[model samples]
Target: MISKYQQLRAQALPHNRATLMALLKKHGIQSLSVFYSGSGSTGDTDKITATPPEAVARLADVTVSLHQAKVEVLAGVAAHALIAEKKPALEALREFTLAWVEQTHCCWANRDGGSGDVTFNVAQDTCRLKHTEYYTGSLHHEYSL
Candidate 1:
């Protein structure tokens, strides 16, 4: 049997892809990339770039990479707390992605640390999401009298 997470992922992937594709086409962007990085005690940072840099500017206010879209989609699904949730995966993902491209200010250290990159190739109909997380370790100290 497939897990709930897997089921939600399968349902959301196509929707997320379509959302990105539509955004790219609407902005006349042939390709786009989003870079993200964060570290402990520091904060997260992200940058969005497109084939025609000007096209990126055309996005106006709402823009997001496939990675962020998927993350939000899954999060929304999980938050519903039921498989028979009212919000469909497609609509949830579209809504989330269209609302924010990157977080205004976030501390990754709060959840450890992480970094990643996401790219969309309109011509190739390809989307790639890569991510790496950093785990924290504890240190021991001793005192002498």
Candidate 2:
């Protein structure tokens, strides 16, 4: 049987790739690498590669699971940036995730599909999922694994 992540990836990957490309061009980023979830860096991320598309394609893959119906990039809302629409920001996030993926595997997204997660719409703006698990009953508590 196909896992939830696999199914979502099949549905989202095409749009995600398109959005990622737009973001890469917008940022003028020539190269992308990462210190992903469980990996160490050699500290060699300063070199420009001149080809992000191919580079991104060659990057690693992350298998995150989303069970909800929507997701969105958190940067715009998190940084309190003024975004007229959410699509652009979501694309930007896709680009960043691609960069991350290039360096590791499995982004480990929410399976419940919260509002702060990443979601894209073909006819409308991207949707923002919510985060409901792993709460410690604190308003602004920060925790990391």
Candidate 3:
């Protein structure tokens, strides 16, 4: 299982790589990976075979995990400015998590299969998937693990 910190970092790639780098740098989050979870045209078919080699070529502390169902990272979100301004740690985490999810749509990559009923829980600091719009929730539940 990938750490929540790393997953969030990779997902943020679409929004701002520099922001992610800075965030990770401040907190010392070194491990990272990008994962994809989706079904194929047929029930038994598989689409993705390899991770996007180019995705993390230039990014440090990041890797790509393709054709997988779930990814998790253990990380705290914090505002770069707040850190620079010397704000409280908890305050920065709260603001950063909300902004990260709202600004960056990590689940957007799985659009063809629907947002997959994706939900980001700031309180729990976890991303949840109840189901995919294209398939049943059971499949998602299995993939989620």
Top-lDDT candidate index: 1
CA lDDT, candidate 3, residue 23: 45
Q: Give the TM-score (vs. native) of candidate 1.
A: 0.52
> CA lDDT of 13 in candidate 3?
35
Error of 1 at 68 (Å): 12
- lDDT of model 2 at position 135: 22
**Model 2, range 1-145, lDDT digits (tens) per residue?**
8644345444554455465444545445453322212213211122222244454443224232221123355866422221222333323454444433432333333232111222322223332222222222436778999
Evaluate all candidate structures by whole-model CA lDDT and list the values in order: 0.56, 0.35, 0.34
| TM-scores for every predicted model | 0.52, 0.30, 0.21
The local lDDT score (0 to 100) that residue 110 gets in candidate 3 is 40
Worst 10 residues of 3 by lDDT: 42-51
Against the true structure, candidate 2 has what lDDT?
Answer: 0.35
Best by the TM-score measure: 1
List model 3 lDDT by residue over 48-136, tens digit each: 11123332233344332211113333476442211123333323333333334333444432434422232323223344334334544
Candidate 1: 10-residue stretch with minimal lDDT: 97-106
- From the highest TM-score down, the ranking of the candidates is 1, 2, 3
lDDT of 1 by residue, 1-145 (tens): 8555445545655656686688777767898777666665543336677898887667665535442212235745634221322343324333333222222123443467677666788888887766666887999999999
